[model samples]
Structure formats: C-alpha cells, structure tokens
Target chain A: MDFAEICEEKFDINRYLGLLCHPGCGGTSVFMGTSRCTSKISDKTVKALDYTAYVPMAVKKLKDVCVNARRTCAVGNIVVAHRVGYVPVGEPGLFVGVSAPHRQAAIQCMDLTITAIKAGVPVWKEEVYEDDTRAWTTNAECFWLPKPPTHSTDLPQK
Target chain B: MDFAEICEEKFDINRYLGLLCHPGCGGTSVFMGTSRCTSKISDKTVKALDYTAYVPMAVKKLKDVCVNARRTCAVGNIVVAHRVGYVPVGEPGLFVGVSAPHRQAAIQCMDLTITAIKAGVPVWKEEVYEDDTRAWTTNAECFWLPKPPTHSTDLPQK
Candidate 1:
C-alpha cells in the first residue's frame, strides 16, 4: 500500500519504518528530504524551504509508483511522505520508505519510487536563501536531472 | 561525511538520522533493511537472520560510494548501517541514508549508495528458518546478485 502525509510535526523514522514493515519482507528502504544551508542561485545560504503540492494528484501518483513497484519487483509494504509549509534547514522535508522480501528488490524499488516522485509527483519548492532571495523550482529543470539514455546493442544474452 | 557500522546492539533510528542530518543538506534519502518471514529456498519460513561482513573491505567500499556520490551530486552526508546477529523477522537489517542539497541529488545518491553496497560489499547472511532449519547464504549465485549500474540508463529513468 501507499501512504502520504503533509505534516508540521517532526517525522518519526521508527514509526514510519514500523508502518512500512512486513513480516514477509526482508528490506525496507527510506529517503528523507531536508533543507540545505547553501544556495546555488547565490552565494548566500538557505535558512529554510517552503514546499507545496497538488495533494490529490501527488497522492495518486505516489500510489501509482507503489503499485507499479510492487508489481514489477518482489516488494511488500511502502510509504511515501512529503512535508508542506516551512521546513527549517536540516529538517526532514520528504520521506519514502519501501519493504521487500529481498535487499535487491527493496533497494531498486525504493530508488525507482523516489525517481518517479521527483519526475511524476506534483510537488513544488521555493528556496529561502539567507540573503532573502527566493525562487520556485521543479524536477524538470533541476541540475541533478539524469542524463539522457544511451542506446547500446552489444551484450551477450543468456 | 561517510559512516558505516555493523552492530549487535539495537538499531537506533534517531541516532542514525542525527548523524545523517546536516544543515548543509536539503534532502536526505534512507534505506532500511529488515528480515523477512519467507524463504526462497523451500517451504520453510524464515524466523530471523544473522549478518556478517568483511569489515575492512565493506567500510572501504561504503566510504567510496559516499565520496563518489557527494562529488557527483549535490549531496552532503551519507550514512549506512547493517545489523549483525539475531535479527528477527520484520526487524531492520540495514539502513542507508543520504543527505543532499536537492531532492534529485539526494535520491540519486541514495540509489547509488545502496546499489554499491549490494554489489561491492562482501557481506554474508545466515538464515534461521521455521522448524529450526538454518543455513548460510552468499551473494554468489543468489538470485539478487549482479546489481545494475546506478546510472539512469540502466533502469527505467523516471
């Protein structure tokens, strides 16, 4: 199953783990998002971040990722969370956790889940730089975007 | 920063998070590994697991992943932990956390870190199955071996 929350309260790692844990699973993967002290736009540092999301759409997309991962891999329970409102530097702003019957599947699924979240989920952020500069950002224009795929036809198939 | 440990003590989620959290980071991705109730070998169910690692090599590889990820992405801190000895089903077996200045970088680094751990670390496992059947297992010939590269082209990118 998939779950998402926009909370102001401090996120609990154990609690989230417990929620995503399953006796049939062997791995649980988690990711947490935090505000950074440095800003790329300017030399100034960042104090906090303001995050927003199209809740319904974002939730639907998250569930879709969970379902897709479970179907493709041997994964079990899953949880995805993103914080709204203001998040101070170093505080967790987003979290994604997944469980599977094996370490490989869990790790791969969690990785895919986060990548999908960044690419598909309707979450937006505004960086609050220390020098009082602010601007909105999305996954599409991020500096960390994965490079374009390269085609290769040289492999010995089993 | 980079950290790696194999502990017999209780897994402290909060303490792990504290180490991973950094004011210089804007995103943190974590992956927690847990024991499973099902065994792939036979009808026997799994009750718990014991993990052992080639400490020096494991630590070196983990640190390498952390350093490479930090240099390649906007990531800050990377923390990875694996529990050794008597991990009950549904209990955490490992945790990998990554903090970065952006969500994409954090996610990407986390994905790379976990993948590297699975592929490069020389860790072994002993599974205790239901009916008291026990046996040791290695990545050699395991169904999950030979992990794919961390680049986006390897998997369905986003």
Candidate 2:
C-alpha cells in the first residue's frame, strides 16, 4: 500500500521506512530534505525554516505521485511526507521512501518521487536566517519563475 | 569526514542520517537493505537473515568505497553501515546515506556506494527459511560469481 501525508509534527524516518517494508521487498531507498545550517543562495547561517503548504492540494498531489510511482516502477510500498510549520536546522523537512523486490526499482522510485514532489507540490519555504532576516526563497527544483527581490533599493543602505 | 562500519547491533536509520547532515548540505539520500519474508530464489517463506562479515576487511573496503565516492560525487558527508548477525524481516541490514549541496550528487553518491559494497565487501548472508532450510544466497547486486550449492543431492528426494 502507498502512504502520503503533510504533517506539522516532526518527520519520523524509521516509522516511514517501516511502513514501506514488505515481505517480498528487500530494498528500500529514502530521500530526506533537511533544514541546513547554511543557506544555499546567500551562504548565510540559517536558524530554521518555516514551511507553509496548501494542505488539501498538497496532500492530494503527494498521494497522486505515490500512485503514479507504483505504476511506473516495480515498487511494493511507497511513502511521501512533508512537514509544515517551523523546522529547526538539522531537522527533516521532507521525506520520501520506496520499497521493491529489487534494489534498482526501489532506488529509481524514490528518486522520481522526490523530483515530482519538488516540481509539482505547492509547498513554500521561508528561510529564517541567524541575522533575523526572513525571506521566501525559491526551490531550485521548482524552476518556474524568478523569485522577487528580498530587499528594495528604496530603503536606506546599511 | 566519512564513516563506515560493520556493526553487530541493529541498524539505526536516523543516526546515520544525522551523521550525513551538514551545514552546507541541503539534500540527503539513503539506501537501506532489509531482510524480506520471502526468498528471491525459491520463493520460500523466510524468517530471518544471518549476516557474517570479516570485520577488518569489510570495514576497510567500506571506507575505501566512501573515499572513492567523495572524489567522484560532489558530496559533503557519507555514512555506510552493515549489521552483522540476525536481522528480522522488515528490519534493516545495510544502510548508505550521502549528503550534498544539491540533490543530484547526494543521489548519485548513495547509489554508487551501495553498489560498491555489494560487489566488493566481504560480507555474507544465510537465509533461514520458515521450513528450517538454511542456505547461503547471493546478493542481487553482486553480479560476478555463481553461488555454491547448499546441499548435495546424491540420493533420491525424501
């Protein structure tokens, strides 16, 4: 069976892995997206990440991706989860796992599932910097439009 | 730094994931090999899998693979662990995790690291079947040699 959820609670990697296990499957592959201590865009130290998602739409999209993965790969069980609200550095923000009879299929399913979610899900992230600067950043995987400027030139320079 | 070990204790997915987390890395990918309830060869019901590894040799080989992965992929942190002894069905036997600034490198590193271990490490597994049959099985990823017979059938079937 497939499982998908958008939770406000902490993401449990083991619990999800357990749910993905099957009697006939020997391999499980996982992808974890964490709130890193450093920002990829500005190289500034990051404190935490605040996530907001269109709950109903995001959950439906996650479930749809899990179903699609089963048809595309030889997957036995699949899990996809994203955490909303505040996530501290080194904590997991999103998780995806896949189990299959073979290693290749499990690996392929996990890779594809994560890519689909990043590209299609309506989840948004705001990086909370150590310097108290917060801005909505663009996910590199979502290459649809350019992000708006964080600071306006009309403001006085520091 | 990289970490690799041949452990006798149960595999902890979260601990290894934590080791792979770094301030500069935003993405982590993992591959976990578990003990399945069914055998891939005979389709027999399996209860558990007993693993044995030449610790010194296996650890050395694992470390070497980790180093090679660093040179190949744009990875920041890497962790590989294999559990020796009995691993129950749906429990993890082996785990590999890699973290990188981007998703592509993390995924590639995990994929290659697991492949290398299955092919080169001096680890062995004996499948314990529900019917009390025990036999050494070949890892599906190790595509090199043919496995020896578990029992000789010199006489007629019982």
Candidate 3:
C-alpha cells in the first residue's frame, strides 16, 4: 500500500525510506526538497519558510499523484509526505520515496511523483527573509489562484 | 564535508540521507540497491548475498568517484556507502545520496556515482541460492580481474 500524508510536524526521511522498502523490490529512490538559505528567484537570503495547505485538497491531490505514479511506474511501493508549517533552513519541506524491482523504475517513479506534487498540490509558501521581511511565493504551476500582473502584456494593452 | 565509506555492517539510508542534507541544498536524491529474493540471471531463489572487497582500494576509489561527482554536478554534499559481508534479502547492499541546489544535479550526480561504483570498485559478490548452491557473480565493470572461460571459443578449439 502507498503512504501519503501532509505532516504538521517534522517529516523524517529515514522513516519514509524505511516505509518504502520491500522484499520483492531491489531498488529504492528518494527525493527530498529542503528549505534553502537563499531564494532561487530574488537572490534574497532566506531565514526560513512557512508552508500552508488546504488540508483536504492537499491530501486528495497527494493521493492522486501517488496513484498516478504507481500506475505509470509499476513500482512496488511509494511514500509521499510534505511538511506544512515553519520549516527552518536546511530542513526538509517535501519527501518522496519509491521502490521497484529495478533501479530505473524506482528512480523514474520518484522523479515523476515529486514533480506532480510540486505542480498540482494546493500548497502555499511564504519565504521569510533574513532582513525580517516575508513574501508570499508564487508557484508557476499553481494556476488556480490569481497571480499579480507583472508585465505590460498581462495588462490589457491600452 | 562529504561522507564516504565501505561498511561491514548494515547501513541505514535514513542516516545517510540526513547527513547529505545541507542549508545550501534544496534537493537530495538517493539510490539504494537491495538484495532481492530472486536472482536476476537465474530463476533460482536467493537466500542472501555475500560481498567482499579490497577495503583500501575500494575506499580510495569511492572517494575519487565522490570528488568527481561533486565537481561535475555542482552538488553540495554526497554520501556513498556499501556493505561488505553478508546482506540478507531485502536489505541494502549499496546506498548513494547526493544533495544540490536543484534536483537535476542531485539526481544526475547520484546516477553517475552509483554507476561508477558498480563498474570500477574492487568488490565481488557471491550469490547464495536456496538450493545450497553458490556462484560468483561477475561484474561487467570490474575489468581488472580475468573472467572465467565460458565457451569453447574462449579456449583453443581444435
């Protein structure tokens, strides 16, 4: 059975990897997304990150993604869990694990699983900067929410 | 700092993955090779696998591979540990972890590291079958040793 959850507490990679291991499977692949000290877009130094998710929607999305990955990859087992709360720099924000009878399937399944979660999950993030300022991060894939107009093309050209 | 070792005891994936996590890295990818219940070559069931290696040479090769992976993939940290001795079915025989600023680098680095270890490391394996039979598994990449003759063409066909 697949294991999927949105944790309010610290998520452990060791525990998740162990959960994904199986006797029939020969390989396990894992991906961990951690909170970095610097923001990728703005180059601003980040102290930490605060995450919030629409609990019901997020859980459903995670389950759907895991199911899709399992079907596509034909892996033995999988685990997808994300942390929803204050995550310090250097700590994990997302964790994904997959096991299969072979290495390629496990690795491919894990890659796809994480990509789907990042793109489709109803999760929001606030990047807390070292300067004591915070900004609501906009995800390119979360298209359900309205994004602020950025360029002239976004505005109806007068 | 990077973590690299050839272990005689069972290695834990959780510990290695945690060690590879760093504040500067946003992604961590891991690959684990486990002893399966069945052998890939034969239909025979496997009880366990015994691994032996030239420890000094294996350690040096592992370190070199890690350094090369770091330079090529621009990863923040890496861990490569392989078990030397008996590994039961479903237990890990080799574990590799890589962390980078992005997923692509981490994944790519891990893939390359595992391949290098499997190919060049001075390690050998003996597959113990359930039928009280054992066979020395030949690794394609371990070119330093001579392979046993299999066909008449390998000998002087008169």
Best by DockQ: 3
TM-score of predicted chain A against the true chain A, for each candidate: 0.81, 0.89, 0.88
Worst 10 residues of 2 chain B by lDDT: B148-157
Global Cα RMSD, each model: 12.7, 2.9, 5.5
Cα-based TM-score, every candidate: 0.74, 0.90, 0.89
User: How badly does each model clash, as a count of residue pairs?
Assistant: 9, 0, 0
Q: Candidate 3 versus the native: TM-score?
A: 0.89
Recovered fraction of real interface contacts per model: 0.96, 0.80, 0.86
| Best by the TM-score measure | 2
Off by over 4 Å in 1: A54-61, A68-72, A131-133, A141-158, B52-75, B102-123, B141-158
Looking at model 1, residue B18 earns an lDDT score of 91
lDDT of each: 0.72, 0.84, 0.83
Q: TM-score of the candidate numbered 1?
A: 0.74
Interface RMSD over true interface Cα atoms for each candidate: 1.4, 1.4, 0.8
Cα lDDT tens digits for candidate 1, B1-158: 78877777778888888998889776677777678887665556789887766677767766776777677777677888777678888888777887776767776777777667766666677778766657665454435444422332213346
lDDT, candidate 1, equals: 0.72
What's the best-to-worst order under DockQ? 3, 2, 1
